[model samples]
Target: MKFGGLQLLLAIALALAAGVLGAIAAGELRDTGQSQTLHHFVHEELDLTDRQKAQLNQLENNFAAERKDMEISLRAANSQLAAAMEDEHEYGPKVVSAIDEVHDRMGDLQKATVRHVFDMRALLDPQQQLRFDRQVASSLTSEPGE
Candidate 1:
């Protein structure tokens, strides 16, 4: 329950790093070209059959719908926390707790997203799965404007 100074510092540093990474990833996901990139990777790189592509699209749409409300709530909570943080007395702990709750919600969302993607991957052939993995790696490496 207790942490040394070094341990606490390291934990804070890692959390900050994760926050930065998540922000960057969220920005990338918001990109309009990302939709085209996903379609191209699925069609050409993974060589998903027409039916498979359709199924995948349907699955993604369902995920988007399912997560939409939760995402909005999380965003709103985050904004509230940020606003509250400007005040020291009335909202400090409340803002910190709200931020922590939002972080937990985001972590849950990430886990669900990974599970769904893995389920989709399971439907693909081995060669296609390899290609898909490579495509993801390539996408991660090739940042915006590069």
Candidate 2:
């Protein structure tokens, strides 16, 4: 996609998630000294019970499906936008419309990501919820790799 800004935003979001998960995993590894994947980190750090793990797994899977569909639509919109921009002869209303479509897709993706985060956070207990909130806040406010 030509929307480098949008791509960067998404990358940052994923990076933040990874960094936070890694940090949590690091703390958990003090006793065992074994490396932890993000999935294991989440379970250990969040103190997720079996039921919660199943629920979170289901939720993640559901969001992944929805996100895949959204991505396909967004990709189509971006392709149209790129084609319109590449039409050397004329810059018409089609270009404007394509730009709008791309922006709309970006907005939709952003909304979906935020909603997914909130949905996941809702599964946590009071203490874990606070930790989740802090992780998100810190990630959003701080630069990548900070």
Candidate 3:
């Protein structure tokens, strides 16, 4: 039997969810020393002194830790909302309010991430800062057309 539009959308969502779980299971999404983006950016882009590298690395670690905690809390909130929705009688104003709260926290987490990036930028010397800005601009401009 041919699937209707809603059924097709549901199937697509299921597939996407399965793909995400599979990636996590395969260790592709695991945190690793080599997978730290800020560290990689500094190593590849900046000519930092040993002391500078150490300080930057510490900052990167702190940012990653805080971001991870925020992500975990967000996931917990989403799961709570989903569980609430599954209860037909209980899915009311409370569920809607919970979802809104989670959305607000997600927005705050994103803004915090941006602020952390700026903190990283502040760690650079004037010459390195100029180079960093140029590198970021070039990377964005090099992206394929929309």
- CA lDDT of 104 in candidate 3? 62
Name the 10 consecutive residues with the lowest summed lDDT in model 1: 82-91
Residue 52 of model 2 has an lDDT of 78
Taking the tens digit of each residue's C-alpha lDDT, what string does model 1 give over 1-146?
Answer: 34567655554554455445445434324455454464466767676788887888888888788667656655665555544443332335865786677677677667666666676777688988887787767766775644
- Please list the C-alpha lDDT of all candidates, in the order they appear: 0.63, 0.64, 0.61
Give TM per candidate: 0.64, 0.68, 0.62
TM-score-based ranking: 2, 1, 3
Return the lDDT, model 2, position 114.
Answer: 79
lDDT of 3 by residue, 124-144 (tens): 889988877776565434433
Maximum-lDDT candidate = 2
- The residue pairs found clashing in candidate 2 are none
lDDT score, candidate 3, position 140: 39
lDDT of 2 at 55: 90
RMSD of 3: 7.5
C-alpha RMSD between model 1 and the true structure: 8.8
- Model 1 residue pairs with clashes: none
Q: For model 1, state the Cα shift of residue 5 in Å.
A: 36
Model 2 global lDDT (CA atoms, 0 to 1): 0.64
Write model 2 residue lDDT over 1-146, tens digit each, in one string: 35466655554454344334333422222324334333454667778988878899998899889877876677677667656555422357876787678667766766787787788888878888887777667655654345
Q: In candidate 1, which residue ranges exceed 4 Å CA deviation?
A: 1-36, 86-91, 141-146
Error of 2 at 46 (Å): 1.4
